[model samples]
Target: MSGLFVPMTKANGLGNMPDLLEQWAGSRSVARAYGRAGLPMEVIQFPETWIPVDAIRSLFEISARAAGDRCFGLHVGKDMTHKTFGLWMKYSVQAATLRDGLIRANQSSRFQQTGGKVVFVPGAQVSFWRYVAPPMQTSSQVQHCDHLIWPTIRFIQSYLGPLWLPEWVDVSYPRDADARLLEAQVPFPVRFGTPYLSMAIRNRDLSPRTPRPFGDGQRITFDAVRASEAAGPSNETLGTVFNTITLRLLEGQTDIDGAACQLGIGVQKLQRDLRREGVDYRDLLNRAKRVRAQELLSDTDMTVIDIALSLGYSDHGNFSRAFRKMTGVAPSGFRARKDQMQ
Candidate 1:
């Protein structure tokens, strides 16, 4: 199965722009490393990484090849292990049950190349990290870095919302600070430090599932295991469902019929599919609206009515009622508490 990543050239402004990827031509070098490993690539699509996880092992293989060489452009490391086993890496880290497993994979990231280190920020009370590497030297990899970092914060919030999600995240590189701000939109408090790039997470989040060994017996045996892991969770289209609903809602729904028309699917089908996932379309909509509301409240001074209108409620009263039902507090009260926290 093919994996979907937000290509820097056209992520459609999901969170952050593809602006940073231009700076890290890491994709080109990784492609060359792949070539050295004996794979012919008409094109390779990274240094624009997705959420760090086992699927990223190929990148580590490349980094190890490039640690240091007579020339910056020369390959220092290469891994053909995945190739030899006939395995193509395309996995999602969000499916992992615990944040700890995610962090382990990220820290042990040589998923594709052994080029950089991801470290924990001391005393940050979150899943903070410092990632650094020399720039890659290729134009095909333009804007790839945005995929790795932008998707990360979005993924944390996606995989685990504010309840289990960190209250805030801070990045620790001065140069990346502005880009990080745009990437994160500074969801909480993101900062840049002198020698590191980091984002703080909640303290409790760092200790989820203990990371399992990334499967290494004979390369053949490990290949089978890796394939199993990359396999879809039985076609549980969570991201697809979410994106579909949001896209429909964003298309200016005037009613359930209009929304159904926009989705190009029967209302019954939508209802049935959502029921199979143990949620109704309304439930999903409210959940999506709740997240947008929280982010808007924390980041903007929009009136509750404006926020309500923006979220597609018929009017302020309905928005208020729905907001109160989704959250325990009234819209104004929620905004006030959010304001106080600031």
Candidate 2:
């Protein structure tokens, strides 16, 4: 309603203590780094509070201008989104395709913490509802929806001017915005006594036209993003080549030179760039292999040998040994530990 409300479900962390600790520590630490570096982490995290950490990581990779270890928040804060959204306010102003945007946001619940829910209330009008998972230490959901509420409204207004309007809206939870003037931004009729966070909209406008051109302008590859996010440009063409090769290797192919040529760079240049990144092409390939191998083992039911070939490993023994070298355990043991964490 008035305050943030993070989800408390299987998708959000299943309400586990370990997961909560990981997320909470991660959020405060990353934000601390941003402030110390004179960059505004809260600017992005606060605006789209309900978004997932994966998406936020992507955003930091796009927005932050930090260097040094601070640039590493791209990796460290990869999943602190859960804690931040606990403070969102859902301010959707100037939304394009008012109803469609709202509905799509509702459908995109997969991008939020679990137990995430969006509902529509129809009582002489329309209302948008967000019911995130409740906190584990308390019987109630965090009431910071307004953190999102303002920014969301501002974003909609900027993107969808002249297409959206809200009837009086109100939520039941505590919020920082004064109750008497809640409509200054929302400017809708408000019945504060209501039981849910809801928007009042015209019933006839439930289905507005979709926004044109689904894609945004800039298009950067994951490798480019990863490199740029580290506060540097493409100093690691081999990392780029390694990424390409890993994709092919995952598909059970082995054309190392093919990947090098695909990037339109010479073999020597690729090798030199990766070496500058403190790794050789083979080391990167092995790292990718180990990373993917660990992930598949931990997240899926794929067998060891299938993963070995998928990573271009000559044999399962070699794969197992490499995995053990990096992770200090066999693939099966790693998977079991991952499973136990769940």
Candidate 3:
């Protein structure tokens, strides 16, 4: 199991998911889904515990199939409330403004899940709230992606009112007949075959608003849970190192020293650790760059040179050489191939 774990609170949605699954698919199917994921149904009772992300993905995929609904993930996300994520939701709801809440959520997301990140990019006109999935490949990310996006939209609506809509939604998957089901539910345009999953929020809607009060009982419980969890062993692992590297790359920082510093470790120690894990730091760095480069090439209209610079390459030639060496295709050629496939 990779060290990547999503808190069980976020996974089972505070016991709401199993009940919903049972309603959508039936008790037998819910059991089968859990069994296939190698997780017992009772695991949802442990909200403070964490489970491997792979298991969560498997559960979503299995449940979607069992429910016989292509939009099952969206439905599941739609049904979730703030209670689904416990403290994570509390942090957001208690903020002074929607923007502040989103920023806090972005910062606190590491406590909710590992291996991926939610980035809140603020802008004067249109800000973007993006979900960057783990760099590792998965069998099917459709349900997982759908599951993530809807909750974020719901969070946004918590402040903007239930009827508020984003400027647009970008999904990485291709448009299919089933996509219409998603499109039908939202007034905003839902674009498919994009590089990432994101929602565009207008700045005007992000004004300061009254903060929601956190009651005494809830605050005491939240603090107790936080203290207890803080006493537990650190969950940091190589998977987290990869996640950190990916985030640093997105910020246009490429040096191993920077990544090591961010991880609170010396460069030599980091190298030694990777060596023990049967991995090389340079290889991992290259892998992250390759994955990000491919995403920019295939999804956005950014020029190859711009992508290269953004990924920290000094010039177009070096980036092309590195990209070709890893992928056997130049950046432009790769983008062309992707376009043809679409």
Candidate 3 lDDT over 36-144, as tens digits, reads 9755564564444455566677788888899888887777777776556767667666666888877877876666666667788888799998877655334776776
Instruction: Give each model's whole-structure lDDT.
Output: 0.42, 0.45, 0.72
Where is the poorest 10-residue window by lDDT in model 1? 71-80
What are the runs in model 2 whose C-alpha is more than 4 Å off?
1-101, 122-124, 127-143, 151-163, 174-178, 181-186, 215-342
* Weakest ten-residue segment in model 3 by summed lDDT: 1-10
* Residue 107 miss distance in model 1 (angstroms): 8.2
lDDT of 3 at 285: 82
lDDT of 1 by residue, 161-212 (tens): 5334345444333443234334333335444343434455666765554243
lDDT of 2 by residue, 1-342 (tens): 221122221112211212332354555555553344233332331132222222322333322223222222223323232333221112222224556445544544433333336655555655554434333332222123332343334333433444454565565455434444444434456555444555555676655553553234333333442342231122334324544554445455556576566455667866766666677767766666665676578656778888887777788899889899987999878888888999
RMSD of each: 18.8, 19.3, 19.9
The regions of model 1 sitting more than 4 angstroms off are 1-235, 247-269
Model 2 TM-score (2 dp): 0.36
In lDDT terms, how accurate is model 1? 0.42
Which is the leading candidate under lDDT?
A: 3
